[model samples]
Target: MIGKFLNRINELSMLRDNWNYEGAKPIHATVCRQAKALVVRLSENILKSLVVFPDVDGTLLFDVRSDNSHSTIFVCDNFFSYILKKKSGNNEVFSGCSWNKDSDVNAMISKIEDSLS
Candidate 1:
């Protein structure tokens, strides 16, 4: 479960870093795995530092500070078992990433289309 999360986060960071050389702005990325969540503070299209929770729980945490001290985001995220099982609230939003524990540590993350009010 965590391997995928790390890979995805790394992938995002790498993507941001790649964009950096070309003059793209850096973006923040948060990842959660086994109560160990990580928040990376990026600057000028590069990863500046990180904030990690070695022991934490719950869903959807965000870091709003400019320094990115320690907070969580409304990621609209949670965990479930499999494709056959669905127990989500109708009004809830999903981030479109699923981890198949039964299978390889591989996880699939998708870009979520959120409705802005």
Candidate 2:
């Protein structure tokens, strides 16, 4: 179970690394929102599969750190948000919201799978 959870985290990290949104502002925002939602869902599922306690809510916090940057995915309260800071400076590069639909989340997952090849 731990392995499966780690694999999912790795998959999400890979997706984050390979996500390239060169489109318009609205499109980029949509993609980012979807990706954040997917990350939250994946984290929640992993915690649910691992924890035995039924009331173990708010105790688990999953964060995915970037390998090449100061970006991070923070999962909380059934939502996930991404914060990206500049590599050379202490400034934020981008920050995404924390809401997305099921279809958007699934689409983001599909895009990640497609990037794996």
Candidate 3:
């Protein structure tokens, strides 16, 4: 069943795209990490998506995770997650956000890269 949401439509589309990717068609338009962080450029916005499946309320909404057993925190309604994701510049783990072109962007980029390493 569909739980809570910040951006469900985008999430649904990404799931479809990833499913297609698993079938070997390989839609190179979007990118999704093994840890479930994803970024897809739609129109003029780079849409980032995080998994918060089947959750109604917690920290998992703000932090990146592969599990769906936690709460789905909608940041548009969550000032805390908004601040955290904004500061992190890597909201690719969440359902929605506006991009910031600043030093924080660089820092977040570095953080994600370091996670990869």
| Cα-based TM-score, every candidate | 0.24, 0.31, 0.25
Per-residue C-alpha lDDT of model 1 across residues 9-93, encoded as one tens digit per residue: 4544434433545554333333334223322212221122122211122232332222212222333234322121112222323
Candidate No. with top lDDT: 2
* Residue 64 local lDDT, model 3: 32
Root mean square deviation (Cα) for candidate 2: 15.2
Q: In model 3, where do residues sit more than 4 Å from their true spots?
A: 1-38, 41-101
Give the candidate order by descending lDDT.
Answer: 2, 3, 1
lDDT of 2 by residue, 5-105 (tens): 54544443333222344321111233333334454555333334332110122212233333333333334343544444444445442223334455544
lDDT of 3 by residue, 1-117 (tens): 122232443353244323533432221222112112322211111112234432122112333322221222332222212222333344444233323333433444343333332
Point to the candidate with the largest TM-score.
2
lDDT, each prediction: 0.28, 0.36, 0.29
Q: Assess candidate 3 and give its lDDT.
A: 0.29
The number of clashing residue pairs in each candidate reads 8, 0, 0
Cα RMSD of all models vs. native, in order, equals 15.4, 15.2, 13.8
- Cα error of candidate 3 at position 62, Å: 6.9
The lDDT of model 2 is 0.36
